[model samples]
Target chain A: MGLLVVFGQIYDPAINAAALAFDRALRADLPDGVIETVPTFRSVLVRFDPLEISCPRLEGHLQELLARQDWLQAEPDDAAQHWVLPCVYGGARGPDLGKVADLMGRREDQVVAAHAAVELRVAMLGFSPGLAYLGQLPEAWNLARRSTLTPEVPAGSVLVAVRQTVLPATPIPTGWHAIGQTPFRAFVPAHRRPFLLAPGDRLRFEPVAEPCYAAFDQADFLRKSGG
Target chain B: MSGLEILSIAANATIQDAGRPGFLRYGLSAGGAVDPYALAEGQALLGNAPDDAALEFAGAGGRFLARSDVWLATSGAEMTLTVNGDARPWRQSFGLRAGDELRLGPPQTGVYAYLHVAGGFQTEQVLGSRSTHLRAGLGTVPRPGIVLPFRADLPHSQQPLKLPRPGSFSRRCFRVLPAPQADLFSAETRQRFLAQEFRIGQMRDRMGMRLEVEGSAAFQAETGLSIASDATNLGDVQITGDGTPVVLLVERGSAGGYPRLVTVISADLAALAQVPSGELIRFQEISRDDAVVELRKYRREINTLKDLVQPVFRDPHQISGLSGMNLIGGVIRGDEEDNHDDD
Candidate 1:
């Protein structure tokens, strides 16, 4: 059995840890019939079959298991995969890159350097198949989404909205500012595991010539953690 | 090989099954039938496997020809179904031989309808699902000149099964379960959400339905939050920046940056899907416990209907043809001379 009433609103840090702990606890402690658990940026949705266990019993079980430990103290997932996505920053490839630089009062190259400097973590995965929501941008990198949405941002485009970098798996109508382009597909039907980025994975962008876009599909994406 | 050769299909028509679940972790929404109840009903009537694929008619019906002997069950919003130019009753199963022509008219009361074959369509599976994820560019879209493959082992029920047809417009209010972000809106906006009647905007599809507050000021979030995109589910009622409410459906994205105010209860999703564009809708809030109980009841009812299968004794076309006559049987059969659709 798990949490009885299965309804709670939470706002807390260590979201990644909580997601990991939640997944572990549900898998390790709970009885069968837990159909699916969708871990989001803030909360985890536990879908269950009432025919197997009543809500009250499930809630009671969940509460007892959760009371044993604080989620924030749980170990974070260590299986983050790294990839070097070749990106062309601050040009037609990124119509919004200059805007982001101007907004931060930094030169275009500095913005690109700062973006490439950090290995961003995938805080969440959603919005589309294989789309990764990466975050923890430095304070100086804070930027808002465009007031008007760009009707279509091509697939593999790097977009910045608020403090997160979103890699859309498909062409999408977006409010986020497109700051770069990549040939490294996060999702491809041709692959066995179509989605590339899982929650908690990490990635860093590598600068490349914009003309490489013509042969971008031939480029290798998965790179070593360092260099 | 048993197959369906599409003669004409509405833009919205597509092949669908229960859909690919467990993929949301990879940022894929469960893209399946918009009106799942309809899908289930068709399956039940034919005693087909639970995961078999069916045709989802999202527009004014579609026309097709049977390439082999096939049995089909119709469910969802009420619509005119005809085989070989004869009117047929909906929510029932009938036999079709090779070369039989079938056509479905636009819905009379709701937006979408479903056609279930005796042996579910054998379309290639992507990630273990026959359902189409239109946004993800997955699965087969039904159109003219396309052939959908299926197995032909199951026998079509001789007696057509009839379940109670839902009244299209009677129920406009749906049950809601407020999500964590419900409190983010101003109290006034929250009240207006349950009290005001919203019209389904033209921009409606499997992904979601944009709702506009009818007549009065459109509901807009007075304040906004820099919320990170998070996992979303079917039935999540999301509020856009402009305050427009979009009700997420089966094809909803795996996650969304917009704040979700509430989610329509699972039991009400079928009703929500049938709600056509421009229709007025209201919401009634309920506790999660109550919602769960209701959902269980709904599932139980559908499962029970599986055993209620019986026969629609006399053939529909046996009558004068136009008289859709069945289930309480009285209307005169349609005149065969009405050749406009006969061709």
Candidate 2:
């Protein structure tokens, strides 16, 4: 563990922008001894080898980087891409779609429309390989994760909770509502580029019929979809 | 084809190396050997490369049959080694002829043991490494009857190397540095943590080891224990909501929300991994400067492992019924000696 440069207390676009900007700057001109820099929701975790630099020295270096610019107003990376993934909502594909609608006091179709309506930013990627935590869902859609775990959610699962949507690349247990399923895999180790999304990348889901989901070449989904 | 066929193996025994790093951004933890020191030791003994793959046996070893002539080395947790029903030195390298059965027993002192080949195991690499990441499904546990392939072309003219067993398993106290959320716990609670002696719990794996303390007065944080999800590093001591401390390891989740109180330094992680369950342990705080110095020393130690290795000269008098022994079939040829050190 090295040090954290906190940008804000809660999840905000500007705060995350600052964190991502700082992360980008750090990665661009990484200081000596720095092992890795992870950009989370509201902070950038700069893990460094203490053998190369002390914590105090690393902190001071980070402070110098922080003072170079007003990170709060930094623009998102220009290379950040916008993705639209085809998804199958409700029924067997989304076991918790009805549950989420019930909690939101809306019909299942309405819930689907509301969820697919807003584009979210990839605020963080963690917990499991290639699992992206997309953020800033409509305030009306803000919900809590389930009290009980859903034993296991498969890859491409669309999970929603606390104004964030999670897309897991592997089967994992979750507390969030699985409202949709996408064929697009965010993580493919065999691919030339394993990770499909990066921090600050924006994406929105496009509802497709279950049959249409099967038509999207599974093997070529990485190249075919996310257009 | 040179290969080691698995006759039988303990549960969770899998292939490992230095592990895959640089994937934390994609939520992948650097899953690798639990005791990297032992892996390096085996490599030194066998004259293998640093990233050579070896079988990491936890708690117990297993039975393997060589399909062809292959030089092998054993390291990590001390375990009884028997080649074709004859006992051999635990930390010595030896040759196994085709059909020779090499059996390893349960560890006598630590959790993980290693079996290395003269040439690294030629397993397929996933994401630039051959280390098994069970949780992430990168590799699978080797099962019985599976053949593990390796390169055995080079003739090892030098005598098999013999290295003394490391005393890391006996270490009880380890060095630690405060984690990012160390201040979340009150100073009094932190002091109590330093003063307390905990035992390794039965719940242990590549991911982490749980520490069990005496009595009901658990270490509590003055602030909220659950922080926003953030990247977790190796050796991080994460305190769960119920007040239990688990030392995250190589195969740990990339990110977690639990408050981390401290992190064991890299140099001491191998020793910490060797401490058996029920072993009592205490953590002492060390400054970043000191930890860095220790790491440099550790790197130097690993680099000079070849210096510690000595030739295991076979004694003619010690060989029982030398005339009746099938020396040519079992032993390596002496004339093939290539004096060049592979390291």
Candidate 3:
């Protein structure tokens, strides 16, 4: 029974760096029975077949790889890219918009301005397919998640909670406040890559008029290989 | 044309295979057979390729009409199977000619039963799998009246099937590795987590299974701080805000907000899938090295299953036409047939 766990400080920059570094390195040249590698904000979960590589041997190999390279100094992968996405921030699209503004003690329009002003980093994708966890919302938007969970929210809903924003890839329940809706679909099953956003991409929100945003048919993007 | 015409079905019955892996980056959990070993067992019985597609039915499968000569095998979940109104043995390959009828009753134990045809089922694949990932809206769930196509052109299987080693379908304990957030729980809560037996909640599905806490106070987190949502895979146990721990499965969302307390290792996940609601479950923390060793042992056992298979001399007692069936026929396939259990 060999199951190995490597833990890291969640939200620690260096640990996050290590997770991505190890994840990339592992996928590039993996041993037989290395089932999967999941990189989180602070941990790298390595699932391997023990019959193929003993736990101690697998651990040694991982340690050797980490010790061999300075992951912190590793060059940023050029594959990472940035994109501008459109969103509708109020009315039916954003039921919690006024509440978010009230929580921040700002006018409704001012809240959208502040939210749209910053570039959000995609930290990780999980909880559903293609759902990217974008983080470090300016302190003004750092409202805690609701204690009560909503039974379901539609896909492409932009949520803010715990100083982070998430665009759910699938319609799912959430405790986070939905402040907006976007036409940008992160997941397209028929696409070659399927997920529009990855763990390392950057994105910014551009507020659009309700009519235009409403007319932003999500199905239209399906015809063009999803961007 | 040879196919299986479903007479009835539960809502969740779907075509499944080895699941879609290496696609988590696309925001999908690897949607595959809930009990992959069952698929392997059926595949082994048919001598089909490892990744061949099969039918995964939940409780209450409907009657089916086998059109043309069809070789079929079943695994996972304990059920009462009847061919032409006579009791049929499970976990063995059996043949049915055109118009023969087979009925499967509700599972006696467990929740998923895999139906594998000789050459495997025919279904459109999504992302390299025919599995139904309901959350991601991926493949089809075969229901009543559906004519499920199989590879009738492929050669028929004459191989015997192995009896599942006792305890394969009804085990309750699983080995787990502590998650990164394991230390967040108080020592007392951690103790209770291991000591208390958790019952499976009725809110079970492919995404995850909720555990009934039964007054256990395993609800303590070191910090009020929540981790940034991270990547979650099958078998991760996340403690929800209501203090219930939901053990995620193959159709889980890519990530979530709750603190994950522990994760089940891969080797034990298949058995866990078959565990029906109300079944008590116990978890033990094992060393990483030990877990790996256990997985190796499990893999070894799976690989050697072929040796356990031997051709069965079966019985025949019925004749069925497209219009109707006759069950009282006294014609037995052969005197030397293994119909000793048929009575």
Candidate 4:
């Protein structure tokens, strides 16, 4: 097949929903010879080998596909629609929860309530392999990213910055504020599809009690389908 | 079987062919010989195919002991090649006896060198290639006392060794084509890039080489634009956030975030590969058509070289001098009377 391009808009409570929507639209229409499409907060990067397809031809095909937007009407099947991610907020699991609450001038409970208030869409998987950038956080919980980046944040960290939540798939340096930790590993390299979360899928992080952390191991939960 | 046993191998040495391509999507770089031209030339000296995997030595070449009688050749930036404490010729094949020690000293001309055995270095191929990805640490270096295996039957050679034309090894001006994001830079900055001379920074490797541009004006107007990271290839001159231009090499990152000002032509990548650190480099802009013409010329030269070494066959039925024979009077002269002739 040649190139297939589709256009659409996606909505999340926090951050810019339009950008995520564009990425989902791009993935749905990728043609043959495309290894993988890289999505960001603003645009999608469609990569192809020049030997298989020329740059000018690919660019021209993309322009035509983008012009047609019929694929947006097709709803995501029930199996691909949404995912419920279990999270533990505050305490050692979320070291920056208190700091985030302080910055927003809100109580810890209020911050937790606001985070679970709306369904977030997986905007993109970037900054690192399999790291899902989920958005948009409620305006009340919206905050700027830290001025200085943390040297190495652990994997499965539920980070909040610029009014969005990011679940890092691997240990990486980030400027986001750590508000919580998730027992569910969104990314597992050994799995056939390493990343469970894909752009356009809905994500809702449910807060759990601190005592519940002992009942499950983060690594084991990642091994199984649902935490 | 004839083979070369490792005596003193350095880090990053591995068997490399003509890079594993078509796997960029799998997050794997086409890991191949850093100096493919030299590798090909070394193989050509043994009358072997260009795709044969040869030992690629990085940083410092290693010491090896010939385990059996075999032919070997070395090519790349001039490294001190010696056999049994006596120097052997570079880019030409020579017979080596058992127990002979072959040593390659630090690179004096280029960073990487290719060592090819008559029957290529036999190594386990992964993903259809023996090329090593050092950053990923997939392959192990040749350890001291390691015995390398090879096939006993060597390909029969019919022609004498034909040397490749000596190429310029020193650093010099490189021809560049405008990159996809060349227009992102200001006109003044672009002009400054063309006018200025850049020094190869010490932070150079197979992945990339940082070029230290002398004046700050090289990035004056294009200071703070945040460009999205994208895949880059060799010769891509990316401007880092700090304003220095880093010329990407063979094993460059699958993608990058810096703005690329220009891309060096594929034909000139070999020349740029030989450029040593601290060497002065200047960029000369050329049209895309001109770049293609240069690449075509290189391809033609290779084809011509290949034709020169092709084996020739003889036809026994077609006898020479048949047309030159003339009937000497009524009776044929010389031996014509004894042989069968038209009555």
Candidate 5:
């Protein structure tokens, strides 16, 4: 059995640049049998088939690849599908908006502006199937996750937590602040590729009035076709 | 016509064959018999194929009235078996006449027991298996009035049942292979895992078993990694953010994000499946080669046992003499005093 060696520190939260660089380097050197590699703010998970390659072998391969440092650090790929998600930001649609604005010491409109201003990147899709974690929320809107989790949140609920935005793909429990609700469904099981959003995709939240929200809701545009 | 009619069906009675394997890539777990060894043993006793379907009774067993004469065998933890109020020996095949009542009591020792008919239970194969996936709602349970079909052509012989050597089913040590993320823990934490005996927590089922590791050590870093949700198989021990160890089982989700610490070997997985709550469990790390060797030994033993029972059909003369003596021991005799306790 060959050795599969993994390089880099176990997990470090501060340096996203180092994590991204290491991900690219590992991909360039070891492409075969690398089913998928998911990079987070701190660490990376490289998965492979155990039958095809033993853990020791994979570990050794990683160690050698890291030592050589032959791979170049490429820029983040900009080729991503952009999606404009329509959302109702206040009232029943956004129950936590006032609370979040109070926590941030900003008005409701300013909180909405901060949320919609930045172009969020889909860092990863995990925690549940099709749940995409979008990151780099505006500095003013950065907030910690709720102290306790809500029993259950409906699917398509748009939440914000720790400088990131999450478009839930399923009916899952969460501790994040549900700042708004989206009429655009991000995941549809019936589609050829169920998740409309991918790890590298970009999202822009477009605010809508209550009347427009009602129209979108009545039209059922959020529900996937044939869903 | 040959069939077995249900007199009383237990709460969790369901048909199971050798589980559906090699489907993890498609987001499906291999769901099958809770106790594969007992299921295979029941088939071997009746000279049936290893993959034949059988009724897996959980916690409590059921009652059945034989509609026609048929050969059947029962195996797993010493459960009481009765034929028309008379006790019948277990782990052995015997003939049941029409209108004969067969009753099974609660397990005296183990968690699951298997009942195998000479002709395998007839059920539609779904996704390449006759196994019932309760979570997926794929197969219907045996109802009280349901009639199950059997093969009429099966040759009947009154051979002495071969009983397995009795072994204690109490607390036992399990062997495991170190997981991919095993190195993530400090050397002391790893040592603690080997030295400390953890109790099986209350949260356990077909999906996973939660182990209570008292006085938890700082196992993994506070900062976590976002691992891509990939295939998670049986015996894979995953550690959550809170440092609790959860061993995934037969019906576990196809993928997960938690860091895995170890994967128990295939040979020891059966032992892990039957471990009840509050039972003490400890892990012993073994090499992958050793694990494969142990698995081979178990398979060889079963194959040898199957061959031992195959010759009775060809030599009918040997069984005919023993049939007259009534091989069924522990049967209640004609004592009116003994019948009073039953009421």
Candidate 6:
């Protein structure tokens, strides 16, 4: 059985901070039968082995941990890793760039500038393997996902919607608008550490021309922790 | 140095083991053989480690040429097997010499089948497992001209053995426990779900399977259908916007927003996986204690399969697809007579 600890009704950085802190604490001093913990936008899902521990008992233990802190006001973890990756925006690489710019009532270059202006936090890794959802973009950037899916988006495609940015390591169908393409590889199964960015890791994108982005050795860039 | 060379293969054939758990936080699901009971039975027959990797074939298996003398065991979804162009019985261990061709045909009843080698397949481990997660691009799919390696140094003196085939392939009634959002579904809706005989839909895969309920009135939650996307569990029966019920499987996503009405218990998931598309199925509500007790009993049953392995008493008629081969005494003679009649 799994226990979900939800902090709020909607997405909030403060709630995410509390959830991440709680996740770390639980992992550091795990309860018996606690298989794993997954932190998301405003909640943490603690999966436990039902055979080893009953749901009520696990719930009581989590209640005690929840009462230990005012997680809503807790500061974000300082140990979170930061990365700045090179991205190519508004071209054939990202077919929906023009559409997204038009929706925002801004030029393509302005959209790119606005996207690269802010640092985002990796709220969660989900939907697909190594797909990170980085979020809390300014309210002005909040946009709805496409009514129909784009059918397929290549790996390293940077997607934005609902005040969040998503980076996929493999081809997938998405409702989000493809704003740019990144040279960095977010997931490499052959590497010792397959997933490059953890849930709480912070990241920023540096806009680069298509020609310069093509010269990068993706594996090498990932090894250097983003060049 | 011992291995098997793929002569021809169908799509979706790959190496799998018990699966990689504890990685769901990274958006990766535990992707193992859909029919894990079959995997266990084959491993028991060959005396391999519990987590030893084996070939998981979806629908149909392929033709393989043994690169060296090796013992092989087949289990799950009774399929047609032929060694060196001679019909062989499924669910039994047999030996193949260097350059012997082993062919596997389409399954007769179930959707998944397992093939086991003496020492297990020596494939490179990714994230502590050999199970292929196709959505994650974690492992390579077995294709023609690829060589699956295994340990040749191990002793190969074990006798040919067979176990009773799994009975779960035909199972239609699966027991389910309440999911986190079960309360959102009213008593009437829950009762309707139990009363309904749902047919498996055509859109099925490792990720999830959609169940087709009768008529346009699918089970609807009076309290709306959308929930904040939270971590999802395997076997979760999630209700989509159109009121369709989808049971998430081994390769399910880590998180989803749909309201989950119930979750099938772990003990019956393997059985549910074998139930082919277009088949009728029903769900039975089970309490938490009952589900735990059932799971324990299922694990014990699987653990004791090794004791049930017995020497194969040749019964060509009892086995399907054996009509083409010549029938002799209880024992059959072939070019490799000594190895074929181990008893």
Which one wins on lDDT? 2
How many backbone overlaps does candidate 3 show? 24
DockQ of each: 0.45, 0.67, 0.49, 0.11, 0.08, 0.62
> What DockQ score does model 6 reach against the true complex?
0.62
What tens digits encode model 5's per-residue C-alpha lDDT throughout B176-272? 8877667766667777777778888878766778988776663563345555333464688888777888888777765576767778876677667
Q: What tens-digit string does per-residue lDDT give for candidate 2 at A1-227? A: 46878887567889989999999998998878888888887888888877677778888889999999999999988888888889999888899999899999999999989888898899988899999999888887789889999889899999999888999999999999998899888888877888888989989999999988888775665555443
The residue ranges of model 6 lying beyond 4 angstroms of the native Cα positions read A217-227, B223-226, B315-343
User: Which stretches of candidate 1 lie above 4 Å from their native place?
Assistant: A1-31, A61-66, A73-75, A90-92, A210-227, B153-161, B166-169, B186-189, B215-225, B315-343
Chain A of candidate 3 compared with the true chain A, TM-score: 0.86
lDDT of 3 by residue, B1-343 (tens): 6799998877878788998887664467788888877778888888878888998877667789987668788887867888889787777776676788998888887788878898788877778888888878888778778888888786442434555543766678898888757888887777788777989888988888898878657566777886655667578889998788899888887666587788888789878777888889989988876776777777776777677766554344233341133211222333334433333
Which scores higher on DockQ, 3 or 5? 3
The digit string of per-residue lDDT tens for model 2 on B1-343 reads 7799999999879899989888887899989899889999999998889989999999988899999877789999889889888888877787676888999998888889999987878887889998888878886468898899988676533466789877677899999999888888899888899888999999999999999999858877787434578778799999988899999999999888888899999999989989999989999999877888888899889899989997776655566453243443222322225433331
* TM-score of every prediction relative to native: 0.85, 0.94, 0.85, 0.69, 0.62, 0.92
Q: Output the better candidate (2/6) by TM-score.
A: 2
lDDT of 4 at B272: 82
Tell me how candidate 6 scores on lDDT: 0.83
After superposition on all CA atoms, what RMSD does each candidate show versus the true structure? 6.0, 2.9, 4.7, 11.1, 8.8, 3.9
Q: Give the winner by DockQ: 4 or 6.
A: 6
Better of 2 and 3 by DockQ: 2
Predicted structure with the largest TM-score when compared to the true one: 2
Candidate 2 residue B104 Cα shift, in angstroms, is: 1.5
> For candidate 5, what is the recovered fraction of reference interface contacts?
0.01
| Regions of model 3 farther than 4 Å from truth | A1-18, A25-33, A64-78, A210-227, B67-69, B155-165, B186-191, B213-216, B219-224, B260-262, B315-343
Residue A189, model 6: lDDT of 80
